[model samples]
Target: MATKEIRSWAYDELIRSPFALPQGMLGRLAGRLMLWLNDPGELVTLIGKADSVLEVGCGPGGLLRNIQAKRVCGIDPSPDMLRQAARHNRGRDVELRLGTASDTGCPDGGFDVVVSVNNVAMWPDLEAGIHELRRVTRPRGRLLIAWHSATGRSPIARKNALPEEKLARIDHALGEPTRRYELKNLTVLEKHCQR
Candidate 1:
């Protein structure tokens, strides 16, 4: 099979059984490794103090814990991951749900800010995911999409990296972004809604 296909299959398997693949200690270590690799603080900084925030592909609820929003919701394809997120975010105002990026099952214009960090590459359909993100964001809301590039040449980084053309297409679909910038190994795409 092709490399992308292999990666996708692996991702699918992981989503289906995140707790069993790497096994016991190894799985715990791998989860921690992922947590260390994904830091969405920069994305949260851009979010400011939104009333409601939705995070697509939120693994373990790291970003949800940091965000100072009145309401926070996190969606991910892995039930195991969501369970971990629920555990990590105990006593916090957060909701964890099982959903993919393209079909979050959130209400229309329900969030003041929508974010996806380090999860775009795993999206089954990128354009459809973008549309879904836009659909759930309120008019004049903020959208923040970000990814990490300094993953020590990991296959996941290579698989998930957005090409220039794909980035352009995402920008086109979202309309002009309010700001686009890169910090350290992180690249962020932000847009302010007009709809």
Candidate 2:
């Protein structure tokens, strides 16, 4: 757990902003805002079809609801968020659990695809989170890490877009042969093959 050390205090603080780590009543409000602001259609299209999918930092399960997979799973650090996700995805076959990016609680090589949206920068240790995500994905499976986009139409997305250096660090952690895609409100870093 702590193996995934915080990258730095300042970065941790920035990532753990109230909206990013929602709690209490305010957290509920933030979850509602997230549901309205973030759309998963582009991601779903990019991911295409899969037998199974795992969404880390799944927030309110918006992506989970839209993902076209026979088996969909979501993990989040906040119990409140997990509750929201469960409620939001009711009547669906989605599995919602309380977990973090560094500890997904998923079996190794169990997923065809593992994705994290709008929470890559929020990860306490980007490398450790990526490593865990990689561990759970089958060989040649896709790892999709998306965040606010620099070219986003929304000011919120533009303001929160990661700097190039930070993006490069993520690229390095994901290893070579990764591709970058700019969607309406998200910048997706897609990696294939497992180290």
Candidate 3:
């Protein structure tokens, strides 16, 4: 299937909602809401000054703004989200682009750290997305995948938190996680190095 068709199928079968793939007027509105709902300070601290960072499914670039990287780039499938992200990170050196997890238009081994938050479950092909993300990460680099936490304070987090089985699937795809822990409203899987 083409990317667009896959996205449409994924929207119905995997995501079942626009909350993951924000687009159009409603998507722009969703981007604004995401700016207020998600906070990236703790994630930034964990990232801790990488030379380059890439955020997959960056949405409105909330985390891109706070990342302490010398070079920062973010990609989302939605042009509307990219527009919002560009506006959100305006006057900053962040690069906002239209791309997806399986086909990020970045050079090989280009990023010190690659992260995806709240959108992994929506990826049309889990293993393919993981493979592409790893391809972009340098040797001994890190891949951080996070999702809403079941124990989070926000109801959205609680509702969206993946089941243990689903989390286990992600862990298997990424190999063993260096650490798996909850940070505020997110449950994070940190994989150190490409194995």
Q: Identify the leading candidate in terms of TM-score.
A: 2
RMSD (Cα, Å) for all candidates, in order, is 5.1, 3.6, 3.1
Candidate 3 off by > 4 Å: 1-16
User: lDDT tens digits, residues 1-195, model 3?
Assistant: 112223521234534344667766666777888899998877888888799999999998899988867899999988878888888888999988889999999998999999999888888888899889999999989999999999998999998788888888889899875689788899999989854
- Indicate whether candidate 1 or candidate 3 has the larger lDDT: 3
> What is the TM-score (0 to 1) of candidate 1?
0.79
- lDDT (tens digit, per residue) of candidate 2 on 68-178: 789999999888789999999989999888888889999999999999998888776888888899999999899999989999999999998888989999999999999
* Model number with the top lDDT: 2
Better of 1 and 3 by TM-score: 3
Question: For model 3, what is the error of residue 66's alpha carbon versus the real structure, in angstroms, after optimal superposition?
Answer: 0.9
Worst 10 residues of 1 by lDDT: 1-10
TM-score of each: 0.79, 0.92, 0.91
By lDDT, the better pick of 2 and 3 is 2
Q: Residue 73 in model 2: shift from native, Å?
A: 0.1
What is the descending lDDT order? 2, 3, 1
Error of 1 at 32 (Å): 1.7
Global lDDT for candidate 3? 0.85
